[model samples]
Target: MAAIIKPWEGTFPPFRMYGNLYFVGTQPASVHIVDTGEGLCMLDTGYQHSLYIVLDNMYRMGLNPHDVKLILLTHGHIDHFGAARALRELTGAKIALGAADREYATGELDLSYAKELDMTYTETFDPDILLSDGDEITLGNTTFTAIATPGHTPGAMSYVFPVTDGEKTFVAGLHGGMGINTMCREFLDAYGLSYDCRDKFQAAMDRLKEIHVDIFLGNHMQHNDTAGKYKAIGAGNQYACVVPGEWIEYAEWAKQNMLQMVERENQR
Candidate 1:
């Protein structure tokens, strides 16, 4: 909690993961771009302080900020949606967030976990689209289905969509949030949040395990070894991010990790 986040210090070079999807975020947080042919669909906007870097990354990737038609957030956390308002204003992109996490974005509930990360959430705005489970967000040639995956947050959501590389199409999945900071006993008891989110988190992981994801997208760079894959792509592996078995492995690991934390807390 004492960590001071210097958003600018975490800039990473942007590159295309596969097909029309591109990575344009920093080391601390991950941002993705979906070139839907008609307009761009931005996955999560990183911290507000690092917005300029994200924009610069977009330009570096040959993407137009003005053509961003949608800013779809994976959850309500500040690190994920901190730059939403400013970005929407700049691109006129409609901001879409999970329905359960609406209050986190609007500042109605001081639970964006900003303070926990040693930051403050100042850019709050109403989401143009309040997505629910099974909701579909369509733009141009791409459509993403929203799946409710709570536990990380009450409104955490995972998106599944199809991406194409001209001749072949691959299914891509972006998991919302998996950090245990909010679900851990210390954090829950301190914030007066329920412990039920742990159960929800475990269930969400199980549910996600059943889904077929060819390309697993991580909200943070470490979750997917984005840097390693980026280098691999540079070395001529065009489909470096595609690992159909990764989804199940990550989901199981996340579920077991949560269970272990709870067990440790009980022992304490």
Candidate 2:
């Protein structure tokens, strides 16, 4: 991952992940908190002092005393789950996530993160929870299905949050790296455009369509950052790559992009 990436730090509506995971990064970065009324679940906790930032957000947003029933890490990346252990201490929440990621988090399994890979690991640790694909986790009247989508990391997983707003049923795709972010921009660039790499990513991303995502959200807020991390980047001349709307657009985009790449690879 791009180590130079800034932690989540800023204000509200300031950042919204794929319009699915609503959150704003702060100065020191904040915990990516998702609260469905009394139900609260953190997709991923950020770096040091970041947990408190989320706690602070809870107060500001009137979402504190948040029933953080569970902490679901999208993967074992340092930035993604560095503060997870702390949340268990602060919120007393149950941790449920991917089994493969659990291996990487606990240090039982270790993979060297290279520049091309856009990840740097000084250390690796084990996760408390080892979840498998098709496992459904319930927290505060809500249930999130674990769908293993490994590409960024051997064990990368995305959580499908079941949220109902009025008459609309929202299925949120909570991935650690669902879309382009500060980390992936550099990582994708560093990795270059090799047919092998493209093929692999295409294969990995092909699994995205297998699941239903009405709202696409990654661990980070910005969909893509051609500029500063927080700046929205999608649209004409826009360096940011996100627009607030239904998550279906994101789901379609991911599938179409993967297919497009696969088609190009076949053409070549």
Candidate 3:
């Protein structure tokens, strides 16, 4: 197992990303705040210790935590869902996640890999909304369609929504999980996952290619060059808004990377 390290300890200033979307996470986890016009919707929470960073960023952007009506998780990974319980308690927001990931979050299944890596997993609470593929999540003016992309985990989900640049509305996509770090035998044994992760990942990529994604976001910033894109946006670069086909290219690249990993493991 790789040594666990705190990679996202630093704070990042919150900024609006086009329309009603805001980035309010640290360097490691990518937490997105979406304004639905009725209430706020948070995408993913960082680790338990990173909760304060999220809250502080929200406040910095003139967003009240209490106004958050929904907390949507990408997966059940500790880094992704760690602050969910606390945020829900603090804001009374309804929490939602993929049904399969809910089992891992609610302790119905073991997540010993997290313990091995010295990550924290404190309390577990039931999700108010259990999501499935193709399910529509409507919150005021914002609506998102869930796409099951089970590679990072059995219940990993991607979301497709709309974002406007004050004039033209474009379809935006947020890939739920991108890492195949849990594909190793040791990690799978610890978590008791038996699915063919590589195959599922490829299938998910194939499905994603069919969707037109003008704006692509990832669960983690690094996955989508988030920091760089944000910098471009801040600098008023015309290409800051990515080209429409970038999502398909990214998916293809990710799928190929996973295939290479599988090949390397087979050689061993």
Highest TM-score: which candidate? Answer: 1
- lDDT tens digits by residue: candidate 2, 1-268: 2222533433333343332244544432234556555577777766533455566666655565346777777776666666666667667777765776666566554432322245555444445678877788776656778776665554667677755534545566665444322123345455452234334444556566566665555555454331243453323322132333434455456546655655665676
Judged by lDDT, which candidate is best? 1
Q: What is residue 256's positional error in candidate 3, in angstroms?
A: 1.0
Q: Least lDDT summed over 10 consecutive residues: which range in candidate 1?
A: 1-10
Q: Which stretches of candidate 3 lie over 4 Å from their true place?
A: 1-8
Q: Sorted on TM-score, highest at the top, how do the candidates line up?
A: 1, 3, 2
Ordered list by lDDT, greatest first:
1, 3, 2
lDDT for model 3, please. Answer: 0.81
Off by over 4 Å in 2: 1-32, 36-38, 108-125, 176-200, 224-268
TM-score quality measure for candidate 1? 0.97
lDDT of 1 by residue, 1-268 (tens): 1112666678899999999999999998899999999999999998898889999999999999999999889999988999999988888899999999999999999999898776789899999999999999899999999999999999999999999999999999999789887898888988899999999999999999999999999989999899999999999999899988897899888899899999899899
Which regions in candidate 1 have their CA more than 4 angstroms from the true location? Answer: 1-4
Cα RMSD for predicted model 2 = 7.1
After best superposition, candidate 3 residue 38: deviation in angstroms?
0.5
Using all chains and alpha carbons, the TM-scores for the candidates as numbered come to: 0.97, 0.65, 0.92
**By TM-score, is 1 or 2 better?**
1
Worst 10 residues of 2 by lDDT: 233-242
